[model samples]
Target: MNETIRALLSKLGGLPMPVADLADDADLYAAGLSSFASVQLMLGIEEAFDIEFPDNLLNRKSFASVAAIEKTVAIIVDGRKVA
Candidate 1:
């Protein structure tokens, strides 16, 4: 999942540096993630993981970093399993 998120970010993040160069907790926004790119990254994540991000999770913090995205995606995917 981390690899997938990093791959998606590499393709959609529009960051000045390579996704591989970033730490899991690195600040993506500070690395140059634009608003539009973040939206693109979110859509890419949904498509890749086959999970929909609930409205409550549709905020900056959810996509703040690689770890944040992993946690958010895990929450939605795991919740669907119990449902």
Candidate 2:
């Protein structure tokens, strides 16, 4: 899941630096993730993971870093499994 999120971030993050150069807990916004790019990243993640991000997860903190995105996706995916 971390690899998938990193791959998606690499493709959609539009960051100035390589996604691989970032730490899992690095601040993506500080690494040059614009608001628009974050939206694109979110959409790509949704498609890649086949999960819709609930409205509650649509916030800066949810996409703040690779780790944050991983956690958010896990919650949604795990909830789906239980349902």
Per-residue lDDT tens digits for candidate 2, residues 19-78, read 999999999999999999999999999999999999999999999999999999999999
Model 1, residue 7: distance off in Å is: 0.4
> Deviation in angstroms for 49 in model 2?
0.7
| Model 1 alpha-carbon miss at residue 81, Å | 0.4
Off by over 4 Å in 2: none
Off by over 4 Å in 1: none
Best by TM-score: 1
Q: What TM-score does model 2 achieve against the real structure?
A: 0.96
Model 1's TM-score against the true structure:
0.98
Q: What lDDT does each candidate get? A: 0.95, 0.95
TM-scores for all predictions: 0.98, 0.96
